[model samples]
Target: MLRRTLAAVAAAALAFVAPVQAQAPAAAPVEIQFWHGLPQPLGGLLEKIVSDFNASQARYKVVPTFRGSYAETMVGAVAAFRSSSAPHIVQMFEVGTGTMMAAGRAIRPVHELLASTGVNIDFADYLPPVRGYYQAADGRQMSMPFNSSTAVMFYNKDMFQRAGLDPNAPPKTWAEVEAAARKLKEAGIACPMTTSWPAWIQVEQTLAIHNQPLATQANGFRGMNAEMRLGGALMVRHMQNLVEWQRQGLFRYGGRDSAADGLFPSGECAMAFASSGLRARVMREARFQWGTAMLPYYNDVAGAPRNSIIGGASFWVMNKGPNAGETGGRSAAEWRGVAEFFRYIASPEVDAKWHQDTGYVPVRRASYELTRRAGYYAANPGADVAIESLLRGGAATDNSRGIRLGGYVEIRTIIQEEMEKAFQAGQSAQQAMQAADTRANAVLRNFERQNARAAQ
Candidate 1:
């Protein structure tokens, strides 16, 4: 009788516990924070990508936060790192490559992170120039190239017709470009030509496309002690041309960075030298027909049409510290989540869509092929100009490969400042470039001093 009573009591207890267990809520998904700098539709698209990833799996949730412009975003990230509150992933512009690479213990290299998390993304699968820009000296990829772009010529076809110029035959040489600009001016165009990213389009890309080095030691790729060589013959000639054009009212000096991007779409400027990524914005805002072509080159230079270097930013993963039960470094679960998110974004479908939607060149070979096979490039004429320009010479030379200089952001500012002074203050182009070279070298030396331990 005593055994039977005990059995009944145990069975009742088990039944009550099972009901309570069944009513318990499931564990919350891991939240992975991603910080980036792209604005507007790009940021919205990125968020949608995160949403899709979250919907695809229940174990992870990625939240994308747009910090600001590229420069602001980088500054914010640095501050966050100092405070030990950095996000899992941060988008950094290409010029900031050296800074990110030298940030020892603050970054977790993409290669190392992927390996630790058992994610297999072959760096070889990415475009050569895209992958090459973010690689360390040993060729290990340091970050993930996301929005890769190259400088290209965007011109108003209607304006060309108005100027009695051939709309289809865009200018291919600097001489031809000058002639066209003059014709447009004669046709009563207020702003015959303008360029965004003066330092990048007029200086850096000019050097790269002409197969010239922006700095010594293979543009700082070989070592950190490289010095500026901007006051060279070619740079002087180009700067002088720009100054002359400005004086003749044939070219308008757009503000720094992408401030001049609007002049083209608003139909004020007939021609623009800007990032190929501007295609999307131009397509959206322009009421008249527009076309794109490779950037005009100096035909007299040897290998005059060498490949242009990439301009857009890449995604850098951050490291907090060693994990201490979630209070320090990223946990293994978080790393897995990040790796999964990267794999999702890098897949052919996602990458190709991103390239198509944002006008960014496809970073991965598979993505490019997939888009081409789908007839995307054919449907969107001139869309392939960026990739073509990047692959112009078949092989990247030391000068045309890519710039990897430290403190290049500040150096670019110095270039723009000197160029402005040359345009407005009556300073000779030669003198301005010489000043730029001197000031920029000081920044490089300071960066070298700060990162001396990296060399060791």
Candidate 2:
């Protein structure tokens, strides 16, 4: 009787312990790495978002690493990928879309990953123009659009008032801009006009605003077989105007992007052409009252004043490693996470806050409407310029959507160098543009041939 009682008690204890062991949670968290170019405040913002995501979930955790600027981050990712140690996602600039897409089997399409995981993400809800560049010809999204921005004019209200120009009415055409520059210069303003991202603000904006193509085949939308078209009459005329303005003491050509930004925020320049995304930085740095305006257009050009192109970056997902799973495979759970993240980021409230903070256009129509209904535009008077610039009912021509060329970042550098020669040196505008066109074509052709072979 004693042995039976002891055995029964022991079996009961064993059963209780087995149930507790079976209900215990698993060890270790799934780590997902993200590499981005945002620094300081923006970087902090990203970390906060990731932290929130982690705290809201139990299975996966996101780790964000700042890998320097966009170019540096891309180079680092390429090197890391070769060693099979890249982050799950890398943020690349808008100009890098062609290169990233041509990177062969290295990247996985965002759509494919989401569909495989049974996550329902509506691509149509995203703003068409903002997401268009990252989409395939058939309209499949390849990357996640983040920090999309367009070029705009920045002017000092006090300077305009002092120059006897209406502070509320900014220049609407290229001719008016020149007149204002002359007025500001005559009024003894030290630097009447300057610009940042010369290639982007001056050349790219100039091309788009004038409704002219930057390359053959509608700015490379057709394919890699396209050639540079920067030597056209419109381009030459614009360069000549800038060169002439420099000679007339109405415009100052700052060194490059950083130098130009310094000129504007330091109160040395009364007017500038810069990215709309610079609003936050300028608002923080500028001591004077300032406002933004739509980029000016040439009067003679037919269908002029088309939408400006984007200058920021997007996120691309890598297609290898545990996250990517086997060939043609992505783990259902991982895909679900990616899709959820995208949907969360694209939510109306999230996009509105991002746009309000970063000065980037809200990537959803409802976000814009929500902001307007909330009187964001009324509180911030000139804020609608960027939205109007983008959504104004212009036909979706290839030129207006912006360039889609490989090795375009290097090509932009070449353009800057050649334009500097024309504007700073004594080289004729025609000569400078011709040389730039020749050099840029070489890059385009080289990329075309290389990518063609890879495709085959």
Question: Cα lDDT of all candidates, in order?
Answer: 0.88, 0.80
In terms of lDDT, model 2 sits at 0.80
Q: Candidate 2, residues 1-456: lDDT per residue as tens digits?
A: 787566556655654553344335673445677899988888787677778777876666678899999999999998877766777778999989889877766787888777765666666766666877787766788889877888888999989999999999999998999999989988999789888898888888788877788998778766778889889999999999889998888888887755687776777899888888778888889999898999888878888877777778888888553222243223334445566666667778877888887788887788899999999999998887887887654545677777788999989899889988887666998998999999988998889888897544
Q: TM-score for every candidate vs. truth?
A: 0.91, 0.91
The C-alpha stretches of model 1 lying farther than 4 A from their native spots are: 1-25, 321-328, 454-456
